[model samples]
Target: MNHRNPILFEVEKTLYPTVYTLWVYPDLLPAFSTWPPVLQKLAGGADLMLPGVAVPPSGLPGVERGALCAVTLLGNRAPVAVGVATMSTEEMLAAGMKGKGFAVLHTYLDHLWEYGDKSYPPTLAPLVPDPAGKESAGHEEEQEGKEPVTSSSPDPVKHVAISDLSLKETDSCAELMGKEELHESRAAEPAEDASPEEQQEAEDTRTPQEQMDALFNQCFFHALKCKVKKSELPLLTSTFLRSHMFSCCPAGQQLDIKKSSYKKFSKFLQCMQQQKILQVKELNKGVESIVEVDWKHPDIKAFAVPEGFSSASAAQDSKSEDREQVYHAPEIIPLYGVSTKMVPLFQESGHRKGSVLSSSEVRNIIINYVKANELVDETNKNFVKVNPILCDCLLDKSEQDEISHLKWDELLSRCLERLQPLHQVTFFGQEPVVRKGNIEPIDITLAQRSSNKKVTIIKNLELYGLDPQCVANILQQKVQASATISPTPGAKDRVQVQIQGNQIHHLAKMLLEEYQLPRKYIQGLEKAPKLGRKK
Candidate 1:
C-alpha cells in the first residue's frame, strides 16, 4: 500500500473511539520529564497551531511546511493558538522518532479518517470534492482549462466553511467540532502584553476538575502507548470512577490485578487497620501470602481483648496479692524491775504514807523542844540543836559544867576552844579536827585520845543547841585537819563543798526553824565567817 494512503487502508482495523486530551500549563512543563520518551518528544516538537492540523504562520519567513505544531483542541472545538515554537529533534531522536514522524502522522490520520464521518462537521464535506466524483469523467473537464497549480502559489486552500463548534452538544462529533472552533478563536485573538497578575488569573481559571481530567488523559495516553486494551482502561482509571468499589475500599486495598508497586498502598492499609477502619486476614497461598480484608465493615471490638491475656490485669492482681500478704501481728511488751512488782503503801485514811507528813512533824519533834528548853539564844536569836538522846549519852561531868551556863553560841565557842588541841589526832590514816561540844565519827585510834575525847562531845552538840552550819563548819574543819595530818599526799584528799551564797542563806532559814531561833539571828548569819578561830 502507498504510505500516503495508509490511513485509508489501516484505519478500520487500528482506530479506537476513545481519544485522550492533555493540557499543559506553564508551571507543569517540568512534569513533562516524567512522560514517556515518545510523548516528550512529540510535545517538545509540536508547535501551537489550529486544532487537528499542523500549520505554521504564513508570514514568518523561515517557517517550513509540515513542521510539527501542537494544535490544542479544546473540548471538541476548533483548535486554539497558544504559543508557537520549533520542534525539539534531539528529544525526538532520543525517543526514536527521527524519521518516524510519518509513522505517527499516519497513525493519527488513520484514526481521523475512520472516525471522520462520525466526527467531522457536515459543512466540511463541501470543501473536499467527492472522491467518487473525482474518479468519474466529469472531474477531467473541470481541470482541462486550469493552469498548473504550484505547491507555493496554489489558490489559498479554502478553509472548511463549517459553523463554529459548541460544547453543549451530547454527540461526540459535535463536542470535537466545538473544541476545534474554540481553539481557533482563542488563537486568533491579539497577543496584547498581559500583566503577571492577569496571566496568573488566566492560569487559575482552569478548575481542579479540569486539571483532574487533564491528568486522566495523560495517564490514558501513557497506558495506550503500552498497548493496553479497551476493557482494561476502565480498571486502570477506576481511581476516577464514581463507583462504591473505589470509594468504599480501604486506602491500601490491592485489587486482584497488579500494575504499579503497591508498597505505599500496603502502608495505607496497615494504618487503616490500626485505626479499626479495616480488617485484614493473612492467608497462606503457597510460597506467597495474600491478605484479605474488608475496609467498610470494620470491627470496633477487635482491639478490646479479654482481661486474662492483658498486661494491665496481671499487674493489678500482683499488687492486690502483695497487699494481702503483708503481716500485721500484735506488738509484744516486757515487764521489768520494782516498777512492775511493788504495790504502793497507804495510810489508814487511804492517803499514802509519806504524802500525809507535813511541817508539823518537824516542829513537834525538834523545834518545840528547842524552844521550851531555851536552847537557842533569845537576845541574838541564833539557832542551835539540842537532841536530848545525844546530850545525855556523850556529855561528861566536867565538860557539862563548863558548857551548862553558856548560851548556845557561847557554848559552841567554848567547844571550839577545847577541840582545837585534838585537830592533830590521827585515825584510819586521817587526822580529825575537834570543836568543844561538836564531834564526828572517826577511827578507833582518834576516839581513844583524851584530846580527841572532845570529838564525841562535839557530836553531841546536835543534842544541845547547835546549828547545822556549826555542825557543817565543825565537820569541814575536822576533815581538813585529817587531810593535812594523814599520810595520803594527793590533792583529791582535800574536802570541799561547792555551796552558792544564796544556798547558804537558805541553809540559815532552815536552821532557824530547827533551833526555834528568830529570823533576826538567821539574818545576821548570812555573811560567812571570813577567818577560822585562832589555834
Candidate 2:
C-alpha cells in the first residue's frame, strides 16, 4: 500500500476518517495559524477565503495547490481545522491574496472531531516566523514585552469593536459620550457623569439595528446557555427563532426581525452567522435551520448572568401567565381511535401476533421480524426469502399469485396488508401520523447556498435500514465530493447525507446500481429530471 499521506484509517469495515481532516497525518502536514473567526468558519464546513487568512511578516505559509494543510487559531497552536489549498501559496500572493485559498474538509468540534481522540494539537511555534503573523484584521495591538494576542484592549472583556456596534448600541454610546466626539475620541474615553434622564435619553437614541442586535444577542445566549435541552440540538431554524428564541428575549421586547436593518428573518440569521455565534445549514430547498450553537463561545462565558436572574424571570413569567389567562384551554389527551392492526409474516423471538400497532409501529415490528429470522437472501442483499410468517403477512389469498421471493420494498408493502386496522397518533402541532403501513420514502433535495452554490441532500435513509456512517463513507469515495452526514431536520433518529454540487443524477444511479435501492422509495428526482439525448 502506498502510504503517501491521505491515509485511510478504518475501524472494522467502516472508514472512520470520512473527512479530509482525518485523511491527513497530523505530523506530516504543514501547519499555519490564523484568527478564531477563520478557524470557526472552517470548522463549520466553509471553505477558507483569502481576506480571512493571516500572513506572518515573513510571508504566506508555503504549500502547493491541493496540498493538505493544518490550520490553527491565533493565541493557540492547536490545529483546529484542516483544508486542502485551492491555490498555491505563491499563486495566492500573486493573486493579491484574494478569492478562495483553502477548501476546508474537517475541523475542531465537527462530527469527525468528536469521533476521534479529541486530542489538542500542541502549541505550534513551528509555523511562527522570526516574528509573528498580523492578527485579527489589524484589530490587535502588541506590547513591547507582552505575548502577541488575537485581541488586546485594556479591558478585553468590555471592549466591543466599533464595527460590531449596532445602531442602538453605538448611537446610544455615542449620544451618551457626545455624538460628534465619538470618531474624534481616542481609545481612552473622557469620563463624564450624566443624570438619570440623560442616560435614559441616550439609551433611547440607539438605532433599531442596535436594539435588535442586543435583543438577538441576549436571546441567542439564553437559548444556548439556558433554555435549550441537550437533546434538542441541530434544532430547526424556524422553531428555535419562533419558539425558544423569542421566549428567551428580554421581557417586553418582541422577537421581530422586521424592525432591524436585516429586514428578512433569514437576513437577521445571516448577521448572527457572520458573527460566528451559530452554524446554520440549508437542509432542504428554501429551508435554513440553525444546526449548531457555540455554547463554548467566549461571549457566553463573559456575559454569564446570575442563576437568580432566570429564576426571577421565571417567577415573573408565571405570575404574568396566571394574570393573563381568562380561561384555561383543555389539556391535550392521547385520543386513540380504531385505525390499523398488523401481524408479522415471521414469528421471531420478539415478533408476536394479535397486537394492535400503528403503521409506523407495525413497520418497525415487521422489519425486526425480517432481520431477526435471517430471511434476507444472501446472494442478493435487496431480496428477502419468504418464510411462513412473511407468506402469511404478505401473500395474496389466491395461491397461484403467491410470490416466494420478495424484494425488500415489496416485502414491506405486502406486510402492511396483514395489518388489518390503522390508528392515528396526533402530535401537538403536526398532522396525525396514521399507521397507514406506508413506507416513508427517502427525500433528496437540491438545496441552494451562498454564491448560488447547490448541495444535494439525501434524507430519511435510516428508514430503509441503511447505516448512515456506512452510506456517508460510500458516497465520499464514489462521488469524490465533500459529504457530511447529519441528523435530518425535525427528525433526530433519522440521518441525512449531503454532497457538494448537484449530485442528483449521480445519486440516483448510485442508489439504483450501487445500493440496489428501489426507485419508488426516492422522492424529488423530478426536480433534477433526466436529461435528453445529446445531438
lDDT scores in order: 0.26, 0.51
Model 2 residue 106 distance off true place after TM-score fit, in angstroms: 43
Name the regions of candidate 1 deviating beyond 4 angstroms. Answer: 1-203, 223-535
Q: lDDT per residue, candidate 2, 398-482, as tens digits? A: 8525677888787766665544544443322223344534456678898888999888888876554343444555567666878
Name the candidate that leads on lDDT: 2
Ten-residue region with minimum lDDT total, candidate 2: 141-150
Which runs in model 2 stand beyond 4 Å of their true positions?
1-140, 143-193, 305-309, 312-535
- The alpha-carbon root-mean-square deviation between model 2 and the true structure, to one decimal in Å, is 26.5
Q: State how far residue 210 of model 1 sits from its true place (Å).
A: 2.8
Tens-place lDDT per residue, model 1, 360-399, is: 3322433454565556655556545434432442255566
Model 1 C-alpha lDDT versus the unseen true structure: 0.26
For candidate 2, report its TM-score. 0.28
